[model samples]
Target: MPLTLPLAELEVGKHLYWQLGNLKIHGQVFLSSWVVIGALLALVVVGTRKLERDPRGTQNLLEFVWDYIRDLSREQIGEKAYRDWMPFIGTLFLFIFVSNWGGALVPWKLIHLPSGELGAPTADINTTIALALLVSLAYFYAGLSRKGLRYFEYYVEPTPIMLPFKIVEDFTKPLSLSFRLFGNILADELVVAVLAFLVPLIVPLPAMFLGLFTSAIQALIFATLAAYYIGEAVHEEHH
Candidate 1:
């Protein structure tokens, strides 16, 4: 008898489609996203249920995360404006962190879908683009609301020659942000999947651990960049 290995079946670009009138959506992505959202909401609820000067258990963890996020926003957006944007930045970080970790840690493969498999929402193009677009809108709103009509001056303040590039940047910013997160997450998932298929045992453990670390890092990176963008928009240019 000859020994043979089963071929790994990788699923890519496959979406569990849902149709609503003229609109089409990815059901799997939304399903996973809801799971992530539910997890976050549960943690928040439990953590805030009992407020105390001396935190314990889930409250302590929540407070640590909150303080860390606050510090990050303050460092990027400055103390004057960080408080206003802390919620937005913190939500982004927590959502992404949970999504990434859940994708890796959850036994999503056990749940069989008709089309696409369940995974991290961030790994999807639509989700990342939506998040990136939100960041873009946040900065634009921050700038226009804070500076009024004078916000347009940012396009040419450094020099008139910089106007064109600055205008182009508005488009590039969201594009880069969306693609960066989407590519990194999707690539990570694919890499881990391929490794698991090839080894099917002890070999994939290291890759799984590394994926967890990168997932957390990506969440931090996305949140930091979002805060930085908002900070730049609201920054007071000293002449």
Candidate 2:
């Protein structure tokens, strides 16, 4: 017998929506992404306001995260560029990390809208692609800023003989980054959805735990690669 896969029909407007009109203040609408961004912004604001020298509560937790990312940057990119890249890397890690895990905890199903409901922003292709683009832009800018006109030299590295390969390698970075994140998040969502359908209860508990782990790892990988790209863009030829 052929195995039958469960198909859930997700109506575009019901699960996702976009508004178009002159009356719209925002050009494109994405409630899920907006909510994720809003939550991150709120965390930043509250964390900063609550900062204490002798850290306690949320301040202590934020400091721990900051320290962890700072160390990660130093390990992957080295101390020279780590300081400059810390803020961006730290923000990326925390934002993506939170967004991924938050998807599991948020009462998305409990709250009903005209559309289906909110899912993890990072789980969406558009959101992951946007992140990849941002990372690309960051490293491109870093290259230009660090090496001036010579930044293009990376595309012709080893020798002019190797230009084609170098260019191909450079171009693949963003594509790999985008797809890796998209694939992992998409897989996690699918697993959760399928398990919820088939087992519906006790069986999904293990999958949920696994999903949480996968989510954190995906965030870390993205941030690590981002830091690595920035490091390569700025590093001296010998280093």
Candidate 3:
């Protein structure tokens, strides 16, 4: 018999579905997503349960993460409106970061799913597309809420020649964001699975670490761009 690696399968194209009155849902994705979200909630609850002035343990970690997110949102969204959107931006950052990390770190093989195996939520196109759409919505909302009907003027500012291009940009933006995230994460997971199959020991460690790093970077990029888009929408031009 030849060598066999069960994990090499990785279940890339397979999706587990949940039935709901003729509506089919990606059950695995939602299951994994809930796991990721639950973990974040648990962390927050545990971390803040015993808050101390001179923090230690989980509190310190939460404080560090909180401060990092605050700075990141403030830097991109600016001082004036950053606070208003910090929670949204921070949620995106944490959700993606944890989801990516969970997919890579968790040994889903050990946990039995109803159908297919679970992987990173980001690896799914639907998840990324949903996230990108949310960002796009945030951009429009930020502009409209702050500037009212005048927000449409952004397309024609500096010159009317830019109107068509700006309109096209709205469509392209979400496509770019979703595909970039989905491709990178899915590719990363597949590569690691292959490496683990070939070497099965020391070789996959480096790739795993790299995956974690890249996942974090992707999350940061998504959150930063989201903040920037919102910031640009709400920006005032001084003539």
Per TM-score, the best of the predicted structures is: 1
Worst 10 residues of 2 by lDDT: 20-29
Q: What is the lDDT ranking, best to worst?
A: 1, 3, 2
lDDT of 3: 0.91
Question: What TM-score would each prediction reach against the true structure?
Answer: 0.95, 0.86, 0.93
Expressed as tens digits, the lDDT of each residue in 158-212 for candidate 1 is 8989999988999999999889888888888988898888888988898888899
Name the regions of candidate 3 deviating beyond 4 angstroms.
Answer: 1-8
Instruction: Supply the global lDDT for candidate 1.
Output: 0.92
The positional error of residue 29 in candidate 1, measured at the CA in angstroms, is 0.4
Once fitted onto the true fold, the runs of candidate 2 whose alpha carbons sit more than 4 angstroms away are 1-6, 9-15, 22-29
Model 2 TM-score?
Answer: 0.86
Q: Give a tens-digit lDDT track for model 2, residues 116-176.
A: 5567777666777788888889888888987898888786666788888877866788889
